[model samples]
Target: MTFFLLRFIFACLLLPCLWTTASAEAVSFPELGSAVPGHGDVTYLDLARMVIPDLAADKDGFFRGSIPIEMRHIAGPDYDGSPPATSGLSSGDVLNIKAGGKDRLAMLLDLGDSPDSAEGYAVLALYDITGKPALLDAVNVAVDRSTYFRDPGKLSIGPGDDVIITTSTHFNSSQGYVIAPLVMVRNDRFELIDMIYTFDENLCTNRRTQNVAFQAIADSQLYAAIKVTVTDATVPGDESCDGQPPPEASSRDISVTYHWDKNASRYVKDSDALDRLADDNAKRF
Candidate 1:
């Protein structure tokens, strides 16, 4: 009887361990090729699908995927595997950027609207394409549903060329804005240097119709200076509002410049520019 009781206790402990091992073995993740065959065979979408967790096809046949815990750092601390709409991924979702004196691919996945505002967010992953394509690191970034990435060609900044990722937002049928984010490769990782609100515009309303534009010039070897111009006027012949008297016809022009601050790791606008931005934000919100 003593021998039989000992055997039963041992069996119970061993069974749980066996069950845990089997469960772990049952779960598997998609694997990438040991070597990249060719660019045509594999795409950023395929690579994204491999990295993203719990990939499945929706009823409409579009792919759906979730962020994994290991990649949570790329999305943000508060992001909890919220699946982005697969339709958001397009030919423009991936961009080529230079990293570590070699070519790298930057993949952007839209995460939809942020919890705090109507502004959307996204996760950017840098893949080292030297040997076997592998993810270097990822970062959570702010963007819009219709946001797109641009190379901006090359700029003479830092030790090598820098890349600018731009996102645009349409506030309403009549209002829109654009932001340009500068990202650089350093220490084997991609760092966000700054996000510049480069353009904004608003159509006919109680306020004057306005248009703002910015052009970045690499004035120095270390950084770039952004030149901004603003123009606004009240239309005389246009009746955009229903039965409302048009405001007095008036016009104004403003110009401001912003410089890159190395210490602050961002672009710093002059006092006049800062005030203008603050006033604009005050009016928008």
Candidate 2:
């Protein structure tokens, strides 16, 4: 079937990332039913595999920090009551899934409270995973109610122990969609960081297309997190850089994409990965 083949190819592509390691105990998010709670459906590889390097320099590549995330996946199910993964917007709702070690802290991105509807905005919530999860901090970072859906998002690590992400918005009024960079960083206090030109849409007409991915900043000394966005613009804005969209490509309709640039030179996209993920979703059943 198409779905099987797609997963096969995707896994093949990621083969370089896999290694034989001692497998950790597998725990499921029973209530939410995804690898990560509230993230909707996605493949749950072993918790051991889900672990990223620690934020501190002195520690080994594992996050010895309080947060131990058991589940994390860049590609998987779309979490809309579907078994196989599906692409595109499921709801305008922002969810804070249980993450961190032992699900100790539930960091969520709440993107729904718009005048029109919660249609893809941000209302980040950090919760304490008690016997019952307790909402510790609930803050609204950004909102795009006009014609955008902010459902699917990716996570990364920013400088200074910050969490960075890149998410896309599907517009209701425009012809092109938007790709943006957002972050949860601390300044004396924890605050969300929104990059300037994250939108892929024009002030007017962008319809389809989505943006995602947010790789941690490998070199904390040089810059912020590295992002791999999907864009139709062969150069830019067909897929514009965050905050500084190209004038000509600002309002065009296009398909999905995935691209990577080693240097964070204006949000380059890897149309291949995005295209592959979308392609895989279609055949996932």
Candidate 3:
């Protein structure tokens, strides 16, 4: 009888130790800051895995799974940020955004050789945190040194709007670029609008830099528009800009607008403004 009692006591002691060890293995939101593998003791990838239990990197360093098919469809065929088969898993950027009147986690996962920069490919992962962290949706976002998402900011189209805007920015030695995309929640899922607003300013060596201002105007209870006003100014070029090309004359200031078409489920692009911008890009950089 004494032997059985002692054995029971030993088993009880061992079980608590085992339980503690198991509990330590379970990850939570707070543990995202804990030690992982790369980038000091912890990495942004570790935070991603903590938030997304199914997302993991393989032995070869690539992600173990693919993004949801529905998100891919929403991104459309022309979207070039699709995950490559050869790109390995790397660090990412994490931020908070509002969706459904609650806080949601947004992660721009880097899927390129460059881990935490404006260069290389990336995938946007959104998670619903109303309860447990659950992946709401994900999509590939384009990234390049001259044109990539850098220090993305949050914006709302109108008062109490569920739409979120993400900015992509780059400084290509002589010019600065900003591209903002509208992400909205519709039909129980996140959707990417087909239109975008852009701003670019070049160095003063060859041409005058354009100063642009963006404003969100609520047209009505259900519709909104983005107003872009552009004015030109001659900025002095620094030593970094080696080419002292002939100065070009400045043109009159222009105002452009893009409207959200609810029926089309996307924002309608300003054709004239878009064509002019495209032509300038083709002719210049």
Say which candidate scores most in TM-score: 1
Give candidate 2 regions above 4 Å deviation.
1-122, 130-132, 146-152, 158-170, 177-181, 185-190, 196-213, 220-285
Off by over 4 Å in 3: 1-47, 50-75, 81-91, 113-119, 143-152, 167-178, 194-204, 207-212, 230-233, 236-245, 248-253, 269-271
TM-score, prediction 1: 0.60
Model 3, residue pairs in steric clash: none
TM-score of each: 0.60, 0.35, 0.60
- lDDT digits (tens) for residues 89-141 of candidate 1: 22224555555456666666555544554445566677776666677776655
Model 3 worst lDDT run, 10 consecutive residues: 16-25
- Tens-place lDDT per residue, model 2, 9-51, is 4334323322122122211122211244443333121221122
**Alpha-carbon lDDT, every model:** 0.49, 0.31, 0.49
Ranked candidates (TM-score, high to low): 1, 3, 2
Ranking by lDDT: 1, 3, 2
Candidate 3 lDDT tens digits, 82-138: 343443333445555555556666766544423343444455677665544466677
Please give the lDDT score for candidate 2: 0.31
Residue 120 of model 1: what lDDT? 55
Clash statistics: count for each candidate = 0, 40, 0
